[model samples]
Target: MKILHVDTSITGPASVSRKLSAEIVEAALRRHPDAELTVRDLAAQQIDHLSSAHLAAAQGTAPENAQVREDIAAGRSALEEFLAADLIILGAPMYNFGIPSQLKAWIDRLAVPGATFRYTESGPEGLVGNKKLIIASSRGGFYGPGSPAEALDHQESYLRAIFGFFGITDVTVVRAEGVAISEQARATAIDSARGEIAAIAS
Candidate 1:
């Protein structure tokens, strides 16, 4: 299997999301011992945000300036990676109740017209499907289904919507929330998330 591992946590080794994401990948590796793994650390290799220059280059409307060429090439590479992966493991830590801008930039690149999705008589249809998404999410506060802060949660919700738009229905989220609440809470959350990962079908 081709497993694409994407890490977006900027906190390095100290990041809880990074730890959990690594564990999740390890669990998957145990199942497919020889799976081909590709790693993209967005925090380390920062992807340029989508811009007008990028659009102009993509549409071939104007001359390809060096920056525009670079952005367009990167966008194509990101899309290629997304399309080739049979399984995606993403490190999605909540930043101010939403996803980090860097991660959002990557997602923007993936949403290419007539590539990942297309408009048809049946409405917007996804061209990409039959892929599995596993997200390791870390949140400072509790924002699960009936939690007090649920309304403020946008990170996971947005991810679900985006992947679902691409016709990816098999998504598993191993979330470690309330990490900043207390030492006990942090331990419990991490442990619980690890247990869930262990229970995942490989």
Candidate 2:
């Protein structure tokens, strides 16, 4: 088995999403002791945002300068990493009711046309398959269904839509929300998320 772990939270040790995601990976590792691991700490890594030049390069419309070429290669590498992994764990925290821009940047790399998905006569079809996605979602407010802020939530919802588009429908989210509501709320949320993580079958 191969596992790809990506942590986008910039809060280091104080990040609840990272904390939960680490535990999730640990549990999975225990179940698959021989699994290979790849870690991509977005906050600590240098992943450039996709730009017009990169797109042009990808489409073969523009000559590849050194930086443009490197950017395109990095995007391909990121996608290849995802494709090579059998299981993926992502630490995603809600920022202003949405995912961090860093995570969005990484998604752009994975959403390659004719690579991750393709347009067919039946409409668009996802090309990537047979992968498991686990998202550790952290939020400062409640965004679950029926919550007042649910409509404003784009974090987990967007993720589900994107990964599902890539044919990865076996997605699970371990969420710890309302961390800023109060100390007790934060503690309770974290504890609950940990329990969920512990119960995971890897």
Candidate 3:
């Protein structure tokens, strides 16, 4: 088994999402001892945001320039990594009620038409097959199912939609909400998320 752990947190050690994701990975490893792990730290590596050049490349209309070819290759490589993983773990923090730009960039690279998705007579069919996905989300405020801020939860919903577009529906979300509300709430949320991780691991 292969697992790809993608972390988009910029907060490093102080990031709740990062800590929770690590725990999730550890749990997964315990369940599948032979799993091979690949870690992609988007913030640390500074993935480039999709640009006109990338779009051009996706359209197969790259210029004669070498840089365009390089960018296209990079995008293809990123997509390959996503497809190659048996399990994917995303550590995403809510920023402005949405996913971080780093995760967005990674999504752009992977959500290519005819690559990750295809338009069938029924609808858009996802090219990627069944793979387990675990998302660890950290939010500054409560955005649960019925909370007032629930409508603002584009972070998890958008991710599910995008991944589902590619036929990935077996997704598990472990959220640590209200991390910035109060010290007690923050600790409690983290601990609760950790417990959830332990259960999932076991």
Better of 1 and 3 by TM-score: 1
TM per candidate = 0.96, 0.95, 0.94
**Highest TM-score scorer:** 1
48-91: candidate 1 lDDT, tens digit per residue: 99777776666767645786677677778988999999999999
C-alpha lDDT score of every prediction, in listed order: 0.90, 0.90, 0.89
List model 3 lDDT by residue over 1-202, tens digit each: 9999999999999999999999899888888999999998999875678777766666777567786677667667778889899999999999999999999988988887888899989888998867989999999999989998899999999999999988998999999999999999999999999888877876
lDDT of 2 by residue, 6-111 (tens): 9999899999999999999999999999999999998887578977787677777864478777767777888999999999999999998899989999999998
For model 2 the local lDDT of residue 80 reads 93
- Candidate 2, residue 130: lDDT: 91
Q: Quick one: how many clashes does candidate 1 have?
A: 0
Per-model C-alpha RMSD: 1.2, 1.4, 1.5
lDDT of 1: 0.90
Q: In candidate 2, list every pair of residues with a backbone clash.
A: none
**lDDT for predicted candidate 3 compared with the true structure:** 0.89
**Model 3, residue pairs in steric clash:** none
